[model samples]
Target chain A: MNIQLIAEIMGTVAFAISGAMLAIERKMDLFGIVFLGIVTAAGGGFIRDMTLGIVPPAMFSSPMVLPLAILSSLAVCALVAWLYKGSDEELHGERFQWILNFTDAIGLGLFTVAGANTAIDSGYGDYHAFVIFLGMLTGVGGGMFRDVLAGIMPAVLRKHVYACASLVGAICYLGLLCAMPRGYAMFTGAMIVVVIRLLASHYKWNIPRVM
Target chain B: MNIQLIAEIMGTVAFAISGAMLAIERKMDLFGIVFLGIVTAAGGGFIRDMTLGIVPPAMFSSPMVLPLAILSSLAVCALVAWLYKGSDEELHGERFQWILNFTDAIGLGLFTVAGANTAIDSGYGDYHAFVIFLGMLTGVGGGMFRDVLAGIMPAVLRKHVYACASLVGAICYLGLLCAMPRGYAMFTGAMIVVVIRLLASHYKWNIPRVM
Candidate 1:
């Protein structure tokens, strides 16, 4: 699959899992859980599009977005059901945060490359390095918000190297797009982020306090 | 003060009050409460301007908006602290939903008229009536969202004729703008909405059920 398609699938799966876990944890009504699942999957992209001045936003205007959201929701529901069936502990009680980290890393990697490419193509100034950075942040910002609203520690703040990975990839994307094939550069950037994030997860890498 | 200025103040006060109440109920720290308060006071207006294709998002660009938000936050926090002083029971308990209704009415009336006038002044056609109507909804829509997120029943879903008051005033303003003096018509629309909303509150006027 092309990188765009791959990124879309990655973002959709990660977001869907996050939503499903939140719904099951909160014990929301079935419909509410489904609604949240959809929102959690697509909400970040929606916000990103709006901030970029994409008229009419994406979810409402795109055929693929809704189907992707629905499929993602079903995938997450099935996974959670199977996992919960095996154990009596809550769906989001203990293992949820760990799931969130992997999902978040996937989101961070894909969205950083996507956002950087989008900015470069939009005829915005190269100085919109800031916009690329902002887009990467916006992509994961919604989940951070969701966690805060749910009164849990935000994954980004959990010494998880969350935003750092995105920042690195975004910079890498811009640098590689300067001289290389766009596809190669994007893949390289995304892979770097996902690997760094997962390695950080395995080794518990975190920024030390400067003070 | 100009009527528009007065309306803006009323809307800001109401918006801030709702934010403060939610913060207190959520037990958020002072910084979190202030952040919510600022977003609450400015959020609707920001949405309105952005949808209208105005740039820089007036809330961020205009110095006046920031101070207004701060003042609104101060007013709400001071009032609540005074009223519920030493009464932790009421402060942290299942309180009645009175203040929500009060602030919602004022916000709905002010924003609908403000939005309609802005649209009309821009020389857009009557099809833009839908846009003005949308602006009215966006004003109250954020609060409805806030309440829902706060786990309270949405204010608009209640029996009160909230959105109806704004809709009526917007229509009345559109009608009378052509026949009467412009300034007079503006005042008349504002009064009509306020009076109707207050009457609805006291008499429990509501749209009949769709069954």
Candidate 2:
């Protein structure tokens, strides 16, 4: 399988798991958890497609992605249920949070590069702001929606360098795309995001609070 | 010149004002207020167009709307700034809330019909669920985004009969379109939302919360 395809599926699953876990934390029902998971997995691409004017977004175009998202969500739910054995308190501990953060950073990096490549492929590469916006949104939009649904401030706006990491990855992807093979640029760009995001969280870095 | 055009502009302005007020309440900067205002003014249509596969969205097509949204937000900011003379407390009275609610209801009703009509014009009239979904999202999406940005739960999910009222209006528009003239249907549908929303607020009608 192509790296792009693998990244897409992996990112979708990772993001879906993160979303489902947050929904569980929120005490949402099964349907809500599943719904939140699907939206979080797909919402960024949906927003990016809308911005780029791609009708019926790729989420709707390919039947595989939606089912994959659902399956991933179900798997996550089942695993978490078994691990916690229906104990909500156990699920809320620090260990699960570290896993969530690790997976989320990976998803952010993968989705950022994927989104940047899509925008470039769609003839938006020349517009740096547009490409960056699409890439950043594709990385962070789903999580923002998840946070909103959970009634919390979006981490992208307040948390440690999350959106900034995506922005850096997108910029790197676009910059390297002009000089290197697509695969190399994609790999390097995604890794940059993952590394920076991990470092930022570990160091407790955050954008300064204005208010 | 037409009622739809009038409604679109009016609703945009009303929504912008509501968003601006919320931004002020949150003590956001001028940039945040304007950003929230523009998103609230145009976010719904953006979502609807994406669903229908309209690339680039109507927001880009008409340069007029973006500027108009900005202008309205500025006007609102200026008015509130002047009214409060830079004191946040002065803007927090009960009267302002009543006015906010009054304008918000009108915007919701107008946006619901406009969204439904757009869906119908796009050949989604036959699919009642599609029309209803488009219409309701167009009405509620902006406010939801605004609330999320302000770190609060969306009113549609928590407030009295808000989404339900929009749903009623959207259903009414679709039903009436099957038998009546477009103008009549639009007017009736919008009025139905406005009246019901007003009555619901006055009567303290709320969807019951289970947990």
Candidate with top lDDT is 2
The DockQ-based CAPRI class assigned to model 2 is incorrect
Highest-TM-score candidate: 2
Sliding window of 10 residues with minimal summed lDDT for model 1 chain B: B27-36
Report the Cα lDDT for residue A118, model 1: 57
Deviation of model 2 at A195, angstroms: 13
Q: Rate the local accuracy (lDDT) of all candidates.
A: 0.66, 0.82
Which ranges of candidate 2 are over 4 A from the true structure? A1-117, A123-133, A142-152, A159-211, B1-3, B178-180, B206-211
- lDDT for A73 in candidate 2 is 79
Candidate 1: CAPRI quality band: incorrect
Q: Encode model 2's per-residue lDDT on A95-157: one tens digit a residue.
A: 888877887888888899989778878975665656776788899988888887877777775
Per-residue lDDT of candidate 2, residues B119-168 (tens digit): 98898778989989999999998889888777778888778799999999
